[model samples]
Target chain A: AQSVTQLDSQVPVFEEAPVELRCNYSSSVSVYLFWYVQYPNQGLQLLLKYLSGSTLVESINGFEAEFNKSQTSFHLRKPSVHISDTAEYFCAVSERNFNKFYFGSGTKLNVKP
Target chain B: DAGITQSPRHKVTETGTPVTLRCHQTENHRYMYWYRQDPGHGLRLIHYSYGVKDTDKGEVSDGYSVSRSKTEDFLLTLESATSSQTSVYFCAIRVLAGGLNTGELFFGEGSRLTVL
Candidate 1:
């Protein structure tokens, strides 16, 4: 079984400030990582994903996450976030044989104007 | 767009009553999934379908059932609705085959169900 841990429950910051959301996963073998975002009362939307690649993957919206093998972590970072970025963020992991998916509790990113 | 739509956008039901949610997609995605979101918890998969007539249980499948008889429609049923089942339900689709697979999921707006 695979599991994800998002230590932060909430993150508050001002507009244009840099932010980082931490995520950790427990898995025995190679796994696929993903970050999703959800606005108020809306369904989730994919922010980015890390498959078999250069440890670092990026989303067009300026969000990036690095797959750290040794640390068993994949954290999402944005150089600068806008008020529009205010939403809930989630981290998930799925293994090769996993038909089901596991998601972390979540990190609420509250961006203030 | 995921081209996915879930019917009964909002509903209020009583406990022990049976309820069914419908999801329709036009993208022809190979993988379709059902998830629920609750405060303080990330989305949890209730059930998922790989292909028509091929479905499997997820981490939180105890009170829910799902069936896929056609390519574009996936149905999720609550045998006996409970207060605990009162939450927002979302349907997601992903194309796992061919080069069209982006590994990214497309989600519907979600169906809000309140079980009294």
Candidate 2:
């Protein structure tokens, strides 16, 4: 079974400041990585994903993640954050088959103005 | 939007009561999944259905059961609800495009259940 570990439970940052949410996974086989964001009182939405190709994957909202095979980590980062980016972000991992996904404890990104 | 809907957006029930949550999708996706979200536990899968009448257990399936009779409907049931079962439940459908699994999931708004 694959397990995901998110190092930070809460991250507080000022608006326009850079932020990073760490995520690590344990799996023996090749896997896919994903980041999902949940706004207050809303369900989660796919932020971005890493299937193959380049190790660095990016989302339209200025957030990106790098898949480091050696570290077994896929950490999400944004050069600058907005108040709207304040949400709970979850990191998930699934095998190549995409049969099931394992998620981490999640990190609450609090962007303060 | 993937057109996923979960019933009873919010419910308050007592322990030992039977609870059923329904998930409906308009897209006729082949796969549907149930997950529970907690404060520090993130989201844990309870069950998943690949096709009609073909379901499988997930990591936290000890006290949960699921049934899928139609491609658009997936149901999660708790035979006897417990206080520990009080959590927000989400239903998701796998994104399949061009007959390929996209490795992306579309989630529902979630059903908040509180067992007191």
Predicted structure with the largest DockQ when compared to the true one: 2
lDDT of 1: 0.90
Model 1 over residues A2-86: C-alpha lDDT tens digits? 8899999999999999999999999998888999998987788889988786999999999999999999999999999999999
Clashes of each: 0, 0
Candidate 2 clashing pairs?
none
lDDT of each: 0.90, 0.96
Off by over 4 Å in 1: B96-101
Work out the TM-score per prediction.
0.95, 0.99
| Interface RMSD values, listed in order for every candidate | 1.7, 0.5
DockQ of each two-chain model: 0.71, 0.90
Interface DockQ of candidate 2: 0.90
Instruction: Put down candidate 1 lDDT per residue, B26-115, tens digits, no spaces.
Output: 977778999998878888889999999999888899999999999999999999999999999999987554564456777899999999
lDDT of 2 at A51: 93
Q: Give the TM-score of candidate 1.
A: 0.95
Q: Which residue runs does candidate 2 get wrong by more than 4 Å?
A: none
